[model samples]
Target: MIFCTYTSLVSVTHTTVVDAPILEVYSSLYQKYGTKLTCPCTNIAIAQRDFITLIPTFHQVCYSDFVKKSWLSYLNAASDKYLSSDFRSQGGLLFQILASFCRLSQDTIKNSLNKFYSTRFISNDVLDEDLLKNQSRSHIETYKSTTAREFVNSFNNIRDAISGNQLLSGFLTNFDFKPSKYSSEPQAYLVSYVSTVYNMPGRCNCDDTPSCIFPASINDNNTGHVILVVPGLYTGCLLVEAMRQSNLQCLYNQTCLNEIKKHIRSSVSFNSTALSSFVPSRYNASTDINQLLTELMVESWIENISHASYYNRCQPAHCVYTIVGKNNAIYIITALLSLLGGLCKVLYFLTLIVVKIIRRRRGKIVSIKFLVGMSEIYSILTL
Candidate 1:
């Protein structure tokens, strides 16, 4: 009987932004070792991790937008194919993308196999063999043999789970905040103040004065605030006073474009000037963001597969050899028949020997009886 251990999926709540240049490095590594990166489950896990890392960096930038749009388009186009057939297909684009982004460690893959299953499920001993040649085909069946369907099923499950999770909303919230300052000052003056304070460099030798030099008359004005955003299961946003003080206080607040406009209006002298001239803080409310998040979550589902003790138990063998036939029932029946035949032959030979001995003894007994009767008759005639 096969024994498997139950292992929980790895919890990945924290995320960090990985820049494009660094991702390119990982992509290069994947290309170099694509053949060695076997195991669909492990590949999926790594892909998920990569998506989790990349999704947070999505912004209004052209590259980010391109990635988001391209991926979504690919998904839509491949929807029918993905649903109908094995996911490892699609010109191997998904696999390539996943492989390019996630670098799988050999050790981690080796450790993820189930120990008991690994020892007994010996298909073929091709551990040192090159996998590149085998994986060249687009179809999953051409490569994975018995495991092709399983891999496809796992991929689907992950995709479904990610879609169900709705990860984007989980990580994001509506940006809302109260106005910090209101004034009747000129637009240029207000814009200058906001820009100057926002772009101020760190102080070298700090004094009791605030880092941002404000006008003396600005005592009546409200000091601006700094917003801190960090990535996590639930992304956290903290607002802190912009002014430097001995004890810093953080105000729990949400970011809103309207609040920013109000703050700019309060600080500006003109009432009619629109804040549209300045770039508004970009909020990610796009459906593309949801798609990206779902994709990432789907990819991350592979993490559970990679870490699962079942998959980790043993590396799948590429070949199998046996002295007996492949069919267990046939081999067992043949073996039993051979054993029974041998036993029957041995018994038949023993029986033949016993019959010969018994026949020889009976002949001897008859001869002895005849000789005794003849001797007795001769003695009686002589008398």
Candidate 2:
């Protein structure tokens, strides 16, 4: 009975063969067990690149001719008298900064990926689509936002460091500290004013006055040559401010390009094609460099999650579940019947033993009484 009960009441594990696509099986498993069940992976050290893909797009300027040696060389060789002459050196510097920003953005994203694969993922551990997607998004946004802030702060520091009023520029071009008659003003005053406006944005300090900047003439008009002023370019107190405040729409306008080409001695080498907004890009032609810098100059990025690969890596042999024996009607009835048969057999054997003992005792007592009666009769006859 004890053996029968033990066999009947024991719990069992059931395995159900999954007969669906791998992705479907994975989804079903997640739905049933969530993260609680462990699916051991055949390839435990799965590379993140196998399951995730990332592609980044950088600022258009980084891809444009402005940063190319051919274009800068052409600018240098072209007539210095043209309005866009300053573009030869200043444009180079600006785009260099842009290229640097793009590199840092790429590096930061790479590090984030490394960190993700190194720390976040456990290959054999069960994973769900939502969990993976959310994790990817979190890492991307965290790195992007953090790097963007840092990139912008770096520019701000550069901006503040070169102000015409306070920093190196101020020392070079001193302001008139005291009131003086216009006639009595020293030649230094004229030199200071001209130098202030002539250097970069030349007009005002961006920190003290938001509207202090204006488009610098393409050519130095102070050189007594006729200044050629481009339509959309400006020079601010700092090169960064100039990029932020100025619009690049002129670079996208055909007429503007034509005007710039006409001023240059050679039109053949000049980049006559306007900036294209049609090319799949995150930023438009009018988006200024300030916004570009703040965004770390990334035009776009691609994210892909491969559930198939994940499933393949975590290929489960079968689904296993345990069923407890309690409250099961069939098991209960079978166990009870087995216990009843065992108990009846035991009771019958006990009854047989008890009957044998009673029969033996009764026989012995009868015999003893018979012997005593005979002896008494024999004594009476002798007397």
Candidate 3:
């Protein structure tokens, strides 16, 4: 009789909360301070610096206006749904602004710098020192003129591009600053919350005490749910769920069953001694693919835990240390210590009661004997 087992696919989900509002946290220093700002996003700092240095005319003429307009655009973009999907738009605005600068740099290198540098040393055989000096000076002057013209042209192109691009236009529009509903008073308390999901598959064995019970029919599907609550992220908690699959076919398709089978086969073939002994005797090659796939998926999910990066829009400096009035660890520790002090007082009182009882017993013996003797003497004198 051919026996088969089926397993369902599992689904997982997670959410993370941060202490600061998404908008203020992710914005670049340049967007916040303009010409007065230095780039805080290190990944794009070089491009930003190039843009600043090359576009001298823009800085002189339209820099202030650009900063104001971009800041407003950023606020509007925050209200859009797309913000949530892309880590609250970190470096998004800077990317848009720098796009034009990149394009200009590419053009300059291609059309002018490359041509000039290629030909500058082409006639290196000239022996005349005076001629070489004059020619070098001329080349340098020509290079400067070419770059100057390119810079002005690039600025114009960007300005014109801004007028037509809807996203850019919106970003460049001058609008008044209004705080988002998500925004809190800078001093308000905030907490970060994060969530993630994982899946685990059942194992099959044909032994009397098999790891998993095999159903009579291949159509039977079993499912299980697990919830894990863990403390994480600066006084916050994380919840993870491992969900069981209900449909065998659905699980197989979602997790790429065939790929997993091929990989397992390849691994076993390459490392026969190491893996051959571990293969289960009851494991039906065909029926066990579902189980193997589930195991693989669960392992991959677990491995992803170390690689996960939480979406945080807050500035690295202020966000790391900022806490609401008193919800922080320092206050919590103080409260715990106060409770411990009260417990110590109770313990001290119990010790005092025990000591007094022992002392009273000893004193009572002596006092009672003395009292009896005094009573006898008084009776004798009266008789």
Clashes of 3: 12
Query: Worst ten-residue run, lDDT, model 1?
Result: 243-252
Minimum summed lDDT over a 10-residue window in model 2 is located at: 168-177
* C-alpha root-mean-square deviation, each candidate: 24.5, 7.1, 38.8
What residue runs in model 3 are displaced by over 4 Å at the alpha carbon?
A: 1-90, 99-103, 117-127, 157-383
Per-residue alpha-carbon lDDT of model 3 for 1-383, expressed as tens digits? 01111111222232222333343433332244333322122121111111111211111111222224443354234333332211112223432333333344445544654455344232311112344346555655566566656555544464445323311113211111343345356654454321111111244221111112212111111232212111110000000000011112221232332322222212112111111223223322233222322221111110111100111211222222121232345545565677678879998999999899989998999999999999999999999
Q: What does candidate 1 score on TM?
A: 0.26
- For candidate 2, the per-residue lDDT at 142 reads 76
Estimate the lDDT of model 2. 0.60
Per-model TM values vs. the true structure: 0.26, 0.63, 0.20
Order candidates by lDDT, high to low. 2, 3, 1
Per-residue lDDT of candidate 1, residues 232-311 (tens digit) = 10111101011111010110112332232232312112212212213332332322222332222122211111222222
The candidate scoring highest on lDDT is: 2
- Candidate 1, overall lDDT? 0.29
Query: What is the total number of backbone clashes in candidate 2?
Result: 3
